[model samples]
Target: MKALKIAKSPDDAIKELLSSLFENQKIKGVFSLFYDQDYFYGLVTDKELFNKLTPTAPVMPANGGKMLSRLTMIEPPAVPIAVVLKPCELRAFYELSKLEQANLENLIFISFVCAGVLSLKEIKNNIEEKVANANQKQGLRECCQLCENFVPENADLILPLIDGDNKTTIFIKTERGEELLQGIENNLVEEDFDSAKLSSIKEERSRYREKTWQNLKTENLGIPGLIDIFGRCINCHACGRACPICYCNLCYFDSADNDSGPRVYEAELERRGALRAPSGTIFYHIGRMIHVSLSCVGCGMCSDVCPVSIPVGTIFTRVAEETQRLFNYVPGRNLEEKIPISTFEIKEFEELGEA
Candidate 1:
């Protein structure tokens, strides 16, 4: 739990640190987490050549965590991988670890303080113009704006942009992270941060969250209001795809043989009443609530990816806070703590009375 500052020159510090990671082969591959065009992409690092290349491709948020899960199944084993992820991604990975779908032993998690990311269209219209005008449009991504996970959890290294400089304030949160930084400590200068300043920063973040939640609650006042909050959703599942925690090999929606079958169409034709074509926005959200509410880390990426701009993360966090409080669980705070759902007690639900 040591806090340190990179050298005065931020980019130089980043390059030096990355080069060292490459030199030791501590990083088998580097995954650059950035926003490009209008979506989030993970660019794999070329360790052999020490070059960072966006391989003939890019993966959206849908493929991000799921791809990591599939990597665990590779035979002969793959090299230890380095991934730059948000808090939600880490939380998703944590959840997957619990499900036995993924292993975190050979991975290095690097996380950056995210402000918020913008949509693809919004990026093209807004950020692209700014970056193009500045002649720096080469490797940028569009989803960096609306990203709200400024501080990630369970990361080996945490990078935050502070002051006018991109000087990444690197904090070692784990023993592995401390060991990695130990090798590069000589290259960096240590600086004691002002306790008051850190407190102020936290307070500011809290204020932002307070306002965000207030606005969302005000916008969705009641049941009808809540329905209206997601009324514009076309059930595209874009929100699910964008969510780093919504990891399922095969989703229920992927099924072609729905139980309703012909009755669904018959009922629709019988009355002028319209059946919500892509039903289950409410159900999808509720299911997620029940599934991950105890582990929600408030990354805010879910709301960022919603097409209609529903504040899904806010609602999830608001509910998750209550859920975690009830169970006395805080995801990612300590890896040793057992997940609430994973353990049970005979007397836990005794209040329900004997059957």
Candidate 2:
């Protein structure tokens, strides 16, 4: 692994580095974030256009991985493409790749050591303020605060954002990244990465995350706690719409069969004295959990989109962590790690065998 440095601002240096991918005859397309009306991910061939990218924006309105998954699913690049994604976004995209929802061939992923992301509402749709806030390592959403994977894995390149805004370290992790470095070596200064500083931050974040997990026990959040957490749910399904792991073309909850005839409501009314007008809130949520618990990357999109102000992302992350623990797996950490429910093995986990 080699590190490179530049004497330009984070945005400017990143623009120069990413733009060089286009000039290199090997790369054909670029995928990155841009703020037009709102933040958007686009596939642009023009390297110069990357100058406008805000890849490290503090708040994410939606998961960019879902968009990249759709794009790669529909059509792979005829030539190699360089794509820049946040660590969480890259992790979600990696999860989708395992499910075959996304193809990874001809794609070079660029990721960075993430600080954390905040609530979009807290930033109030202010783009300038959002960019400025990216430097702060605290005041993040619940899910982000608990996230331990600050540095991305399996990325071709990892950009380390330092304490200051102007200077940063670009670490080349893969052969694909080395190729890009060779192209821009003249412009880059060789620098040793500040491992001590990075380690200190990781230790601090991990300690904070451990404390949060302890506080969120079921004894502290039982039946009434669940109701209080999701009581205001309008059953709008907006959370599912925003989730990157929910790659289903049509959700089971959205099926016509789920909206049964009058007799179904009558049966429900008979069973429960009276039902909530928009019933099945808990059912819908659990069903989603059954589907995505093993693959959830904890990107916090569900909580971000919830109109009722529910801590959907935090709840899902807690459940996902437990579910993943049962199988001794971490989603997106390993490309070869099979999703538990998708495969069958006879000898595995016999201790838990009901027989």
Q: What is the C-alpha RMSD of each candidate to the true structure, in Å?
A: 5.4, 2.3
- Each model's lDDT: 0.59, 0.79
- For candidate 2, write residues 1-355 as lDDT tens digits: 5877766776666676776656767577778777666777888887656666877766676787888899888667778888888888998998898888898889988888777877766666666666675555644777787777777887997788874757867777888778766755755555565667778777877787678678767448766777777778999999999999998888889999688688988998899879776877877888898899999998988987888888898788888988999899888888888988998787887667577
Using all chains and alpha carbons, the TM-scores for the candidates as numbered come to: 0.75, 0.92
> What is the C-alpha local distance difference test score of candidate 1?
0.59
Error of 2 at 251 (Å): 0.4
Which has the greatest lDDT? 2
Total clashes for model 2:
0
**1-355 per-residue lDDT for model 1 (tens digits):** 4766665443344445666777787665665444444334454565443333221122234435545655653431366666666555566667666666777777877765544333343344465454334321233232222223446767887665454454556676678877776765754444443345345556655666677667666434665776777777777776666555566656665456433577876787688566676765676677777876787766555765677877777787878877898878877666677789889777777767777
lDDT measured at residue 246 in model 2 versus the true structure, 0 to 100: 92
Candidate 1: how many backbone clashes? 16
lDDT of 1 at 119: 33
How does candidate 2 score on lDDT? 0.79
